[model samples]
Every structure is written in C-alpha cells, then in structure tokens.
Target: MARQRVPEGPPPAPAVQKVSVRYAKRGRLRFSSTRDFQRALERAVRRAGVPMAFSAGFHPHPRISYANAAPTGAASEAEYFQLQLTQQCDLDALRAALDESLPQDMAVLRVVEAAPGALADLLQASVWQLDFEGVTLETITDAVATFMDRAELLVTRMTKSGVREFDVRQAVLASDVVLVRAGDADGRDLVRWTMTIQHTTPAVRPIDVMTGLTELTGLQVPRSPLMTRLAQGILEAGGRVSDPFDA
Candidate 1:
C-alpha cells in the first residue's frame, strides 16, 4: 500500500515547563471515572486559556500525566497529575483558573513546579478512611484484630483480566477502628476504619479489606460504605504518608 503523504505544517510546540497538581474529588463527583476527569480537565484547560503543549500528530493531545487516581465511587482529598505547558505560567494563577473552570466538586488543591524525580515514585502508599453506617466500633475493632492476626488474607476482585485473588494483609501497614457518631435517627452508629496501605501490584482496594474483614469475622460492611482516600504519598518510618509535593 502507498504511504500517506505527510502534512505540510511544522510540528507542535514543545513543552517548556511542567507543573505538578494536586486536586480533590468530593461529594457526588467521586463517582466520576478517571477518563471523565481527563475530559473535564482538558475542557477546563482550554477554558482557563492554559498554554498546554500538544504532541505532534494527526490527533494531537494535551501533554497531561495522571498518577494514582482513586477508584470510581471513592472520594479523594489527594489526587495528583502533571501538565506540560508550551510556555511558563504563574503557578498560582494557573491553579486558580483551573479550579474555577472545573466543577466545584473537583477542586484543584495545589499546584507546584515539577521537581526532578518521578511523581509516581513518591506516591508509595495511601491512607484511606472507610465509614460504615449501622456498624459498631466494637464489631469493627474485633474484625480488624482478626484481620491483623492473620499472616495473609486473600480477597478476590474482578479486573479486566478476570477475577483475581491477592493477599490484602500484606499491603496493610497500620489499621484502626473508631466511632464517628454514637447514633443516627435510625439508631445506627457510624464507625470508621482507617488504614495505611502500601502501594502494591494489583493494588488492594478498600473494598478488598472490607471483604477480608467480612470473611474473617462475618462483620457486615455497608453495601456502599463511604470510602475516601485521605492522603497518598511517601510512606514514612512511622507508617505515615507524607505529602508528595514536599518530597
């Protein structure tokens, strides 16, 4: 077959600078998938008049890199991405504009000049909060104890590849249960399970840990527990997750 003729125009402008951004997914917007955020961000960039660098191709796309997006149906206070710009711009201004352009629930929390290292490398762990309604603190505490006592706790999740099982216990660094509210109008107490988990292959999600707890102690986790990623960054010596931007 004859090769297609090349276009006559010059290539797209190269990126002169890169900026790392931390954003939040809150409220109902937590259900938005990663692709949904990508589309929203592209529109927001254009709306904000960002000088985004584009790849040289028939179908040019903005130079944007996303890392460690929270799963669908999970809210997050610390989500991160990077943007390559055709020219330098004031980070504060860029952040304000982008935040204003995006939906109110999807707020741009922080914007920093890109450092020398990979952002992914700094994101070594995550702190998650899972809130369950109608669950007692005692019940959750017992379940957590049972979970931690085990050498390994395997759980299954259906991925694009297929249903797969992995040890959820291995990724867990620390865990605790707390009572958030004594009782609601329905006379159900609110309990929260907070955990610090190391990032691992085929990442063990909060749901997986819930499954492990359920399997071990027959603890009934709410069908749609309020799952939120409180923080994500380097795992510190004391099982703390430090800010990636600071690293």
Candidate 2:
C-alpha cells in the first residue's frame, strides 16, 4: 500500500480577521474634521479597553482605518471603519465599548464581519443627499430640471494634475428634491430644499454641482445648508449591488 500523505493540513489561514464598524457622526460631531473624528474613535477604543490587533513592528499601532471620511461640516449616516483583531470579540461588547468612549454625537450602530476583501477594493460609488437650508426646494428642483434637461452638466475643475472638464450630468445616477425635518440635528429646524445626487467611480464631486447651480442661482451652500450621505451602493463586477460586509 502506498503511504498516502494526508495533505499537511491546510495552510495556516491568514492571521488577521478584519471587522468593519458602520457608524454615524451626528450633532456637533458632524462638524468634526476627519482627523479629529479619527482621534476620537481611537481614544474610544482605548478607553473601551478592547484588544486592538496591531501590526508587527517596534512601534505597533492598532489596525484601525477610517473609510472615506465625510467632507468637513457635512453630516453622515453611513460611515465605516475597519478594525483588525487577534481574537474575535462579541460584537455587542465591542459596540458597547466603542459607544462608551465616543461622544454623544458619534455612535456605533453595528459591527459586521468584514468580507475577505479590501474596503477600497469594494467601493464603487457614493450617493449623497444635499439639503439647502434658507433656500427654496424650487432652487434645487430647478437645478435638477436643468441637469435633467441638458445633455451634459459641464464644469471645469483644477486637480493636482491639471484642469479638466467633468461632465457631472452624465455621472449622476439619481437626483431629487426632498424636505428634511429638524430633529435630525439639534432640535433646530432643518427644512431645506435640496437635491439628491449620486455619482460613480471616477465620479464628480458635490462642489461641481454647487458650481453649476451657482452659475444660475448665486446661492452659497450650507448657510445652514446640510448635506449627508443617504447610502453608498457598491456596484459589483456583475452589475449588482454588493454588501461585502455581510450586513
């Protein structure tokens, strides 16, 4: 009988498990600059005393990374952070720990097992809701009117590389006007007429939309104007929405 080698066991699985935390920063925290928010989360995890898996080196740091942070002064409902862990902790415990260290406005909604993929690799597009306070819905509605009717919403942009023409109208996946109530923020009225816009990879920024509108309306944004991400739908290679985090 030929001696059979029971395959020397499967190769050791990757030593790391990545967990993605889906959170939201609201109220005053919305105004937190991206860097500041990162500090806040890091501090919270430390205080929560959760075992943070770190990289190997003389100066090891917790393997925590923030996904594309929200632009300054913009609020967000859908934000993400990836945490590396040596041993899996109860999601409830991790959430509670994070919550305790976080400020009232910053919150941890849920911790989902991250897919065996890179966050950056999975990102395809982002959808945003922009509410213009002290402005009429018609203003945004009209912009949408112009955007929808025109063949292209052309705007010039200056990049680190050089100036380039971006056709935002072509990239827009969705646009609409909606009313927003106050309580979402500080107990203050937040009714603003605003348009929703979605852009895909190699996408157009919101500032471009503002620039195009200003050409006609001459109104400044967020003079109490608030914008937030409604959701970020990840389009997979198969032309389908993929929730890599196993929500």
Candidate 3:
C-alpha cells in the first residue's frame, strides 16, 4: 500500500452558553424515580435536537445538571436544571422545543439564561402545599400552635448515610392551615396545609411535618397527604420569596 494523506476536519466548538430550565413532574410521573426522570430528559433533549455540549474525554456525557430534584412520589410546580450548549439558543424557542418533546405532565415551565451566581445557592427554601382529607381545621390549628411554640421539635430520619435526628420546626419558616371545603355527604372535608421551609442540611419533608403533628398533638391523618411543592427560591428576610431567574 502507498502512503496516503487525509483531510483534517474543523475543530469542535466550545460550550460557551448556559441555560436554566424549570419543569414540573405531575400525575403518575410523580412516582418516577430521579434516575427515570433523568433518562427521560436525556431522551427529550435528543429528540428536540438541542445543541447540547458534551465533556471532553474518552467517555463523554452531556453537560446537564439537576438541582434540588423533588423526592420521588412527590409532585412539584417548580423543578430546575442547568444545561450547557455548544451554540446560543433563544430561550423561548428552547422552552417550546423541550415542552413539545417531553411528556405533557413533565413539560418545561420556564427557561432562562444562566445568571452569574450558582442556581442551587439561590434556591434556599421551598413553599409546599399538603392536602389532607378527613382532617379538620381545628385539629391542624391546634397542632400548628404547639409546633410553633416549641423551641425544638426534633425528629428522626433514616438516610442513605445513616439515621439522623433534626428539628423540623427550626426549618419551618411559616405555616398555616386552610379549609379547602366545608364537607360533602360523606363528611370528609378537604383541607390544605401550606408552609414555607428552609432547605437545611437534612431537609425537612412534608411527611416530616405529619410526623411532627402526630408527635406533638396526637393528631393523625387518615391517609397519606398529597404533597405538592408550590414554589422554591430565595426566602428573603421579610418572608418574601424571589424567583431564582429574577436574581
């Protein structure tokens, strides 16, 4: 064989653009594991033909990062992730493309150019809505009073690392019980408990609130409450929450 020459190709472009996207997991998909959601999102990115960036190595992965993923089996209106792109993209068009590619319930809610600061740091707290049936406002009100009054409402949680104990009340910024409805023929009234809580070391969950209520006032929920995260962002000193994108 004779020596031959080959043409060189253009150099790969750099990943200079960064974007942040907020999405929601609702209905049956709320039960989807974090890994499951990650796979789905990866597939959606491919389907949408997004100019995503990859790591520079023998085995490269997309430069997509998730922040504060809602626990499996919980629904959320605000979930966020960051994506690195090889080329600039219109935020609105990117949002539309992702919304069209993803499942209806798991659609993207908003997309914004990545700001200067870290996205995770901006999200310091969450506002959660916990729905309960067959629970009266009187019971919840009394429990709330006791929970807020206590200096430390300690609770135990078993994590992957190990069993840890923390005070759930300290993480609770503010809480209130709202009456969703009076009652129906069955005598089950719809009620919702909403609270703004900080993201502490061992984060406090809605179930933890239920646990604290039962521990403090002996009040019980007939069934598992529907846990939904309404919003998440920087919880200000004045108790107002600002969206991460705004910052």
TM-score of each: 0.96, 0.77, 0.92
Candidate 1 per-residue lDDT over residues 63-129, each given as its tens digit:
9999999999999999999999999999999999999999989999999999888899999999999
Residue pairs with colliding backbones in model 1 are none
User: If the candidates were sorted by their TM-score against the true structure, best first, what order would they fall in?
Assistant: 1, 3, 2
lDDT of 2 at 115: 75
**Candidate 2 runs further than 4 Å off:** 1-16, 157-165, 179-203, 216-224, 236-244
* Local accuracy by lDDT, each model: 0.92, 0.67, 0.87
Q: Higher lDDT: candidate 1 or 2?
A: 1
lDDT by residue for model 2 (120-184), tens: 56555566666665545555567667666766767888877688777777665555566565344
Q: Using TM-score as the measure, name the better of candidate 1 and candidate 2.
A: 1
TM-score of 1: 0.96
> CA shift at 233, candidate 1, in angstroms?
0.6
lDDT of 3 by residue, 37-56 (tens): 88999999999999999876
Q: What ranges in model 3 sit over 4 Å off?
A: 1-12
